[model samples]
Target chain A: DTAVSQTPKYLVTQMGNDKSIKCEQNLGHDTMYWYKQDSKKFLKIMFSYNNKELIINETVPNRFSPKSPDKAHLNLHINSLELGDSAVYFCASSQDLDGADTQYFGPGTRLTVL
Target chain B: DQQVKQNSPSLSVQEGRISILNCDYTNSMFDYFLWYKKYPAEGPTFLISISSIKDKNEDGRFTVFLNKSAKHLSLHIVPSQPGDSAVYFCAASGFFQGAQKLVFGQGTRLTINP
Candidate 1:
């Protein structure tokens, strides 16, 4: 079974549209994160949440927001999606907010903003 | 600025040979390092990690070496198998929030030949 799963593995949307990508982890992790992999294949962290609280928010555009209704789920909601958002968004989780623990990852949600 | 860097864009190795992937970091504060492998269309899967306190970490055929003085780290796969062919990323986080926010390298595509 996949430890982390994201809904709608591939999303294609038009510009200025608002959409949300959902993520869930069955590993019973306390921390979750969202990362963006751009066309150059550079993966960068966008956000991190622990116990439903935001911990790290990279200098991303204000149009992007993340919501954690509970510990098991973290959803990325993009408002007025832009062409720059056309990349893969990944959801990851770790057992703790420590450097030593392993971070398991979901398959990925490839968002294509047209 | 890109903190973690994978100088080689790709590496190829013969089956049963050794595959060496190198990474460099500019941040002096980074104390924890990790290696993640990823297949196309999938999120990264954690392979192994090392802390600034240690110089090397090994798991099965995978080994990670860290050289603080050089601000460098590397992942070595011995007896490389075809299944090991994938994109590998190097990440680093410092003595802060559980490596909560990781800075990743561009990524190295490893192709293992039969």
Candidate 2:
């Protein structure tokens, strides 16, 4: 079974369009995170939810929002996407928020905003 | 500011040779460090990790070394195979805003030549 899975592996949308990417983890983890990797391969944490509670929120723009319906799922929604939003979005999950815990990542969703 | 930095953008190594990737961090509070490997069109997978209290940790052909005094870490893959070619990312986690969040460095592309 895929430990982590993401929907719409590839997404291409125009500017000002809104889209949502869904993520699911079968690892039964409690902490889920969203990350963004840019063209230069610089990975940055966008948001994190532990047991459906927001734990970490990086300085991302307001247009980007994360929703965790449950411990096993987390979804990212973008509003009025801009060119800068074109990047790969990754969903990751860990057993908990322990700093030493290992995080399992799903196949990334490549988002292109033209 | 990039707290964690991987100065080398790319490293080429012959198959069956040792591949070493280096990372440096400016945050003294970072207590847990991890290495992740990512292939084309996939999210990063956790490779190895080391805590601040330990100087080294090894798993099979992969090993991680941490030097707290220098705030530096390195991942060594011995007998690297062609399949090992991918982007390696170094990440660190510490208490931030009442929770632990990971900070990833710019990835290093490792090419294992057969």
Candidate 3:
């Protein structure tokens, strides 16, 4: 079975629009994270949640928000998407925040803002 | 400024040859180092990792070496195959994970020619 999966593999929207990307995992992991991969192929952590509680909130804009209804699901919502938000968004899960715990990632969602 | 850097944007290697990828970081607090592999249109998958206490760790054909003094790391793959063609990302984490974050390099695309 796929460990992690994300919906709307390809999202095309206009600037100032609202959009949401849904992520789910069945690996029984305790932590989930959202990452942004820019055009330069640099992946940066935007947010992290452990057991449905927000843990890591990097220097992301307030327009972006992460919500985890349960340990298996973490969704990303953008209040007003901008052209700069066009990038590949990835969802990941780990057993814990421990160094030994490796993360399992999804196929990723490519968001394009026009 | 980028804390983690992968100087080489891409590398080409022949099948059955050895492929070496390098990574450097500017942070001294990073104790856990990891490598992930990714294909186009997909998220990165965890490959291997090393902790500060140890200088080297190996799994099958993959080996990771860490040099704390130089803040450098390398991933070596022996007998590289065509299936091994993908982008490799280097990542490091500082603090107790829960209290900190994981910094990632841009990525190095490796093309294995058969």
Candidate 1: TM-score, chain B only:
0.94
Question: In order, what lDDT does every prediction score?
Answer: 0.92, 0.94, 0.93
Report backbone clashes per prediction. 1, 0, 0
Separate DockQ for every predicted complex: 0.72, 0.91, 0.76
- Candidate 1 total steric clashes: 1
lDDT of 1 by residue, B1-114 (tens): 888999999999999999999999998888689999999888899999999999999999999999999999999999899999999999997654434568889999999999
Could you tell me the TM-score of candidate 2? 0.97
Encode model 2's per-residue lDDT on A31-87: one tens digit a residue. Answer: 999999999889899999999999888989999889998899999999999999999
lDDT of 3 by residue, B1-114 (tens): 899999999999999999999999998888899999999988899999999889999999999999999999999999899988999999998874446578899999999998
Task: Put down candidate 1 lDDT per residue, A80-103, tens digits, no spaces.
Answer: 999999999899999988877788
Give the TM-score of chain B in candidate 2.
Answer: 0.98
Docking class of 1: medium
Number of clashing residue pairs, candidate 3: 0
Ranking by DockQ: 2, 3, 1
Name the top lDDT candidate. Answer: 2
Identify the runs in model 3 with alpha carbons over 4 angstroms from their true place: B96-98
